[model samples]
Target chain A: MKDFPYTESKDTRSGFGAGLHELGKTNPNVVALCADLIGSLKMDAFVKDFPERFFQVGIAEANMMGLAAGLTIGGKIPFTGTFANFSTGRVYDQIRQSIAYSGKNVKICASHAGLTLGEDGATHQILEDIGLMKMLPHMCVINPCDYNQTKAATLAIADYEGPVYLRFGRPVVPNFTPADQQFEIGKGVLLNEGADVSIFATGHLVWKAILAGKLLADKGINAEIINIHTIKPLDARMILESARKTRCVVTAEEHQMNGGLGDSIAQLLAREEPLPLEMVAVNDSFGESGTPDQLMEKYGLNETAIVAAVEKVMARKTK
Target chain B: MAQSTASETHAPEATKSVAELQQIATQVRRDIVRMVHAVNSGHPGGSLGCTELLVSLYFKVMQHTPEPFDMNGIGQDLFFLSNGHISPVFYSVLARSGYFPVSELATFRKLNSRLQGHPATHEHLPGIRIASGSLGQGLSVATGAAQAKKLNGDQSTVFVLMGDGELEEGQIWEAALYAPHHKVDNLMAFVDRNGQQIDGPTDKIGGLGDLRAKFEAFGWRVLETDGNQFETLLATIKEGQGLLGQGVPVMVLMDTQMGFGVDFMMGSHKWHGVAPNDEQLATALKQLEVEKASDY
Candidate 1:
């Protein structure tokens, strides 16, 4: 397995805050609106630096979405910050009518995605956001793995002129990706190349996939690892290429099994290159209050799950 | 597809006399009836009720270059229809004001038409800046646009219209609290206090008590006017414009009849979304007379 060592660990939300603060200096048209989660979203620096561009919308997600859509009318790139639940489900219709259907240039920046929002329980942990956002026609869904990757993605989407949904986690994860790497929207990152089972992961699960890759290598199984950052516009060519070489697949994400990255990749393989596929996702269950590691282990979203999924799929591989 | 680039022949706003506006309102009313009748599906009651307000804004009150319809509308007054069910009137006003060819009104609600049943920006409809069929969203958008105008240092006002029943939506109150709290001064929101909804009167369905008092409590400057009358409504719009940049958003409580022109359709909630039938169209058109009506 290829090494992806990290000197430090950082929460992805801080990366977003840092990127937004940097954009404040570079892009004059970049404006931000937070639904009373300024501190939670780590937007204090941007708010402090560019007081004029920051809007404290006060615990109203629907109004924040509408205002973001409207701000695009005056040529302002609006980034709305809130939890994933409120960002997608609570304001789905508002986003549908104003931002998606109208094709407004609004960035829906969601933090505390999936069960990683530990101690908050299922109410705060949103595992359905990726599905909801990807279903929108004009929306681009991104779920970066680490701090540097999330920060680079945050900077990259500002140049893209359409509605985008950038989701990141609450807990700190190993910051292994390149600090100066340029983010490509729909391109998959190949972490390790192998010939046995292909493991595709996103968000916080990328590190887990790398761990699974190492574990699989120890067991004499050469697993291919890839990071899919963009969910809506899935890197279909890369996924199909990896699947063709490996002849089996194991998809992992800190999201629901029904409509997450696994579902998108499954659909792609089902239509084009049919192969043995296993998914490591929340099996249609809500998470309870627990620590981040406890929730990840209990909900079957860890390196063990990925390694086990790899084993299960290899057993079903066409002989 | 040989269509006119409408801005070339557009007359300057504020140059049209009140008498000229009234004439255009008559034509707009005719167009609303015809467009809805052609589809056999649309909302005409509120459309007829809102003819004068839309005509007044497009013809005399708003400072806009109605041609080459750009999305930003920078340095120009922008208007959004929050009560998008009344799109028959919005489309008629937009087309007649030269945002697009008035003949395109034939495509209203038809297969692959720019004019959806509600106003949408996806079809590249020139005048519409945002989609608003789903209620209680336009005010927040207008406030945001108003903030954008402030950020760009563009001294133009952002106007939005919503139905009285739409106040039942929690988002409107959120916006109501937001606009004034942020000191968004360059925004104007008008509520169609026609006291009607799809089922029955707004008061009977879901009451919005004393909108003026509510807006005032939310720190907005309140003004009331008759929406159907050109003289009173235009004067009220001018006064609302005067209230801009005073560190408070303005709300105009517009009192209008659900159906104003046609004798059979006016003063009731039955015609809220029903189209004029063949016999009803003949009867309604006869009631609304114009010497030189430009019907699409």
Candidate 2:
């Protein structure tokens, strides 16, 4: 089991806000456009520091997306902020023809993603965004784990060109990852090495996977924990190598099991190195108004779900 | 290939001449009919209807350099075609104005052609900056670009065109509210107010009750003109340009007849999306006389 040492806690969205402010100082061409969620998105610092570059677009996501697409023509990198639901579903067509089809370099930054967006219910929680964004050609899909990692990932994407969708959540989670770690786009970070089972997780579920690994340690089980941040360009080689040594796998994320990280890992293994796998994700059901911890437990996205999934897959291992 | 050499050799000594510009408009109309006839596909009615406005903007009003194409369009007037189904007219003017080889128009809608069903930047087309075929999104893009220009302290202006039926889209209103509230004074939007749409007239399908009053109430300075008549279009464009940087965005309601020059296709909504047959193509071509440039 991996020892994740940390004391502080923070939401991943604040990491994005901090990274955006840092970007304003590093690059003069970096500009931001928010659809009336300035305070919710934590974009107040950037707006206060660089008043000229920050654009308050009111409550119009469609127009904000089109404007972001057009801003790229003038050599500006535009980061548009809004909730995941309005960021993807409400403005899918505008993003499709204007940004994706046109091949514009726009950064679509989404916050309050998945069921972790407590109290908003299913109307605002977008579990289908990863699928909708990954299906588009030339889109780079990412879901960072915690505050420091999300901030690192945001700065990294600004240097990397092309259309990118950076998804982050609302509630505060343990900031276990290293604060100064450099984020690699398509590379997965190996948190712990083991020979019994492999655990792949993303977003807020990474900490849960670590806790599950510790619980498995007490039961005479050795587990490998890995963070699969980038979703679209799946790191198949790393996943296959991990499966070859561990012989079984467990995938976790706060999204629908149909098109989330579990589905991506399943597709990779079914083609390359077939292995027994169990998934810890929301089943086919909408969410209701509940606290963050209550929703995670109800939707089958927690440390117990990860521990149970690992045990289930371990039973299927031939070795 | 045929159009470029023929037009270049016989082009007017000065591109700034209004008489020469009117002559090119005649050839543009001929090209639109021929391109739509070749594929047995395209929107001929709206293309013919918007010819005068296209000519007035590209040849007379806009200040742009022809050869050295720049993506940012800094210090140059920028134009966007929001309703991109009317590609025949847009592509013809882009080519005739020397953005690309005029022969490229022959590849419209064919396999592996740069000119797709609509304008796209993915094909590496020079003149088109953003992709559009879906309605109601272009005005917002234009508004954003105009804001960028002002932020950079550049004096260039931005123009966008849309259809009457396109007003049914919710994004247009969202943009209408933002542009005026933000004081995006460098933007001008023109509606091709030729009442016909695919289902029927806009009033019957979903009425955009009083667009002039709607834009005016939304804090836009309004201007009206006959889009089909070249003289009225020139004056109307000048009037809109004169209203720039006045703490308000401008909107011009251009009244046009669908399939204006062709006798058979005019005065109805039947020709909105249908292409011309061989007989209809020949008839439409006969109505448009070849200019001295002989671009087609």
lDDT per residue (tens digit) for residues B94-184 in model 1: 9988999999999999999999999998889999999989999999999999999989988777889999988999999999999999999
Task: Return model 1's CA RMSD, one decimal.
Answer: 3.6
- Model 1 segments more than 4 A misplaced: B1-11
Candidate 2 local accuracy as lDDT? 0.88
- Per-residue error for B168 in candidate 1, Å, reads 0.9
| Candidate 2 stretches greater than 4 Å from native | B1-15, B293-296
Best by DockQ: 1
- lDDT of each residue in B170-284, candidate 2, tens digit only: 9999999888998988888999999999999899997888999999999999999999887888777777777887888999999998888888988678988888899988898
- How many angstroms is residue B141 displaced in model 2 relative to the true structure, after the best TM-score fit? 0.9
lDDT of each: 0.91, 0.88
Model 2 per-residue lDDT at B130: 87
What DockQ results do all the predictions give, each relative to the true complex?
Answer: 0.83, 0.67
